[model samples]
Target: MRRPVPVFLPALLLALTVLGIVTVRLVVYEFGGPTARRKAVTVPPVDGVRITSMTVYSGRLPPCPEPAFDDYGHHDDPVIRPLPTGGPGISATYELHNEDTEVFTYTIRFMFLAGTIQVGAFTDEVVRSVRPGATVRGTVRPETQDPYTCPVTRVKVAEVTKVPDSELPPPPERCPPSGLRLTSDHTAAMGLRVVGLHLQNCGTDDYTLDGYPLLELLDTDRSPVDGARITHGSGGVSGISLPGSGFDEPAHPLVLKPGESAVSELAWRTDTPIVPYLRVRTQPDAAPVTLTLRLDLGTTGTLAVSPWKLPP
Candidate 1:
């Protein structure tokens, strides 16, 4: 039989057991265990910022949507600015409230709705100097004319990104007019004279053209002809498409490479006095080129030009 256990042995064993329990509790708390869960429950949730009120108005004109709000307290019918005959401008104002305690820089984008098309304009980054529980006002106005048929129905906040100064990609460079050439072919059908304006790329690099070429009629004295106007269309020619292009749509921008060519339709009445020369510039700022061709513009004194595209 063993001798009686020492008194110190029992006390040492009890101390070690208590130390092991303490170590386990510390490990669990450090690793997000029960204690961490209890701490998380007591923490408060974060409150963000929002736009409280928005309004659109122009100089002295009645606000769009008439009443501007609904019974339920939301923006109701869209605002339609009557098409401006002159340059009466349009503008929008927004009231923003920051509910949280943090300072932030914000950006606001406006989407102007015109029929089915939506156009967007934006403001620069605005720093909110006001503290939380305070409100600030921001404004946006369109710089360019609307391209769609419908007037702006209402303005919308497209983006409310929270940043002071965001970086944007650089604007694209306009294509240069190098190694480009212009020529034309004339044909008369159904009492209308049509001239196919052919543009060829004779240089190594590609050339692009959009809309209609700048055109003018010149007399034998090399002076611009008075009272001659030019418009755009195929003059009711059905089934007329660019050669090998298989497209019969309106004029659009086109790209051409070496030896590649595109064509545009130009039509005028045959009864008018004949001009001995034609002047064409690929774009508004480009140098004009003169071609000697006999074109009779008739009493209407107008020329209809179609968009350039690949020949059918």
Candidate 2:
């Protein structure tokens, strides 16, 4: 009788242990929540605010498409001023701050509200792009006005955000008008001469060009002309002068959204006839772009802007 009691107690304990294991498994495996992992990423911060303080928002000239008037004695002319003020109307500026994991480019525009009538409000379609972790500034003003005034009344930021891809707007199909063929302290033409390459945002967005090309005239032998110089009269080449003079013109750096292009000009002259190729090198921040231009004596012509294709 004693041996049977001990056997029965051991059997009962084993059965109880098995039952407890089954109950715990059912509760944990079938009823518990899910367990999955995800990757993490960080993004920077950006801020834009309306500037009511008149002191900081002083007016200035908007950037020109091209400073080098490559095309001379051609039908190419700067976009004439339409308003009573003689230009795109107003001058405005905005402050932009970029905060993010990677470097970024921010584009901003201001719209003028004049008694509910918006007249001649323009954005920086070509010449301004901000970088990441930096503050960017932009201006909008009439090109042809004296004492250049800011025509807009109320200024609002058109866009203040970061773009993922580098490409914004593609270069426009129509070449941007290279401003005046001449850049002298004196003046003759009544209006502004639009210059530089224009790009379009065909890619459904906008982008910016680093800057205008630093044009160096190459001789027939494909070498940079050491002493060759360019000169222009008050009214441009239209009011000419001597030979072999080089005009040291600055290319206007600009930003273009989709359907936009950077426009610039090359107003230069040489004593010797220049049928040689015009070698173009873009700014440092931009990709190295080079192009061969065909020069025709006695004619100021427009140079078209295209992407630089490097060989593999």
Candidate 3:
């Protein structure tokens, strides 16, 4: 038995030497609960957006956005321990180097890989208001609930979708009892952008408006946009000449009763910073209502507003 052991030891040493034996170290990472052997998350060369920092939690498998891709088609792997309360987690800070000459909003998709094979996938995350020259910082945790046995070794950006920031939908709001609700309609053609602010009389009282809306543009952070020149008509705002845009309409006193509405126009050039919020007052002293207009207004430095008028 001793002779066999010696022979085996020599064979093992020979194999190790052929494998180019080097000092081996175990890589353990802090995952908030325990140290894990997960690899450091890596981001490949991606345009527009990059992951600046990432933290991955193992021992708890994350549920993929597409459950069809998640493990256990009713069959469990031998290594999957039933996680009573915890699962894997991942949080990443995304730095969008917009490098583009235009402002953009990005939607990123992520997947978890184990040894070159994707073990899970997650929902897409939308990061808004990424202006030119690296302006916005968004943290994405595209995670879900599940218990996976395979350690999340790497994270990969599966897909990325980008759109101009001016095109985003306004924040959703229900018609309130203030007898008024404001919304927007967006249109773009030949690089000209137009947003129609729709004011509806949702309550029983009559809401009256005259002339143009009192306007204030805001950045994504809700701060006033500096150097914004909001003109009263589209004449100097870039698209006032478009047919049926109503920027040329003359302002007159209008009354909106219940079930009635009026539309105001906002126009700007496509080359602009993201104006995500627009503070609107039907009158100079009326309560200000902020709409998520996504107006392409900052870069070009000019915005045009039309008075409340009947919709075309």
Candidate 4:
């Protein structure tokens, strides 16, 4: 045989060449080589901002209020009234800033933890670019729920930047503590005239009074009134100049602290005739639990059964 001419020599050479090429590529890439530099685009860091203030308005139920729309259809900051009664309608305002170079979108929402659980959400227009030192204002309208112990209701930021998850600080606390009474005449056009008691300084440091007291009429036995139109008196705290329905409005929204007591009045008239006293219950947002008033009509316009009177 022409002597396999040491085939190992050729094989060795090929292996050496391959190793050299790989080594060169590794060294080049390790030090900012053109091939490595032309790879994927760089993503800058993203920054976020928190909301400074939020407000809720007062109103009735069913169709709640919405944030005002600008001529361009963009939403504007809302002016909320305190302690909106009836149903769930809240107006929230937020101030935010983005230190990142990219555009971001923010979502605002509310969470009701106690009594009932619900998430109230609203969206803001896309933010094209929040420069390293720029600020933006936003607003959201959240639906309210039926009267219940919404003591832990709060506003939060649900989203920011391109990130799918984000949250904000908890909202201030509100303790709606008040008393109410109801009287029924069964003969007036206005079936029920309601009066309220605003317990002053009955809330925590975080919240203030938003609206007058609230009163609800429940059957002696427990049944929800689906369609009830109750009116309140125009009178303030001094003395009730009660409405025809006899329901007077509290002069100021009651702010009760941890252990404080206040008295209020409410009245209503029903078409159904009864012989025994009616059960009048007061349901507030927070403390002072629920108080029930059992009134015995002594054939005249006066209270026969009150907490002061004990049954013998």
For candidate 3, lDDT tens digit of each residue in 1-312?
Answer: 111244586677678868987222122332333222323334654655566555454443433322233354663334334322333254556656777766777777777665476655665787777777875666765465344444454566765656564434334455564667777778899977878888888778888888999888777555788887888777676547567667776889998888899988788887656676777788876667766656765644778788889776
**Candidate closer to the true structure by lDDT (higher is better), 3 or 4:** 3
The reply for model 2, stretches above 4 Å from the true place, is: 1-90, 125-129, 142-152, 165-312
Please list the residue runs of candidate 3 whose C-alpha ends up more than 4 Å from where it truly belongs after superposition.
1-173
Per-residue lDDT, model 1, residue 192, is: 68
Query: What are the lDDT figures for the candidates, one per model?
Result: 0.54, 0.35, 0.64, 0.35
- Please give, for residues 1-312, the per-residue lDDT of candidate 4 as tens digits: 112346686677578777873221110111121111111112221235454443322122222235688999998966643232423243444566665454443333333232244444334334433444568866555544333323223445543332111111112253233321112322223433332332333334433333434433333332333343334442232223435323332345444444444444444333332212222333354432222223222222222111111112
Error of 4 at 9 (Å): 99
Error of 4 at 223 (Å): 55
Best by TM-score: 3
Off by over 4 Å in 4: 1-47, 56-89, 103-116, 119-128, 143-152, 163-312
Sort all candidates by TM-score, best to worst: 3, 1, 2, 4
Superposed by TM-score, candidate 1 places the C-alpha of residue 285 at a distance from the truth, in angstroms, of 2.6
Best by lDDT: 3
- Candidate 1, residues 153-212: lDDT per residue as tens digits? 345565443421111111123222446666677888876677777777777887788977
Assess candidate 2 and give its lDDT.
0.35
Model 1 TM-score, all chains together: 0.38
Q: How many backbone clashes does candidate 4 have?
A: 30
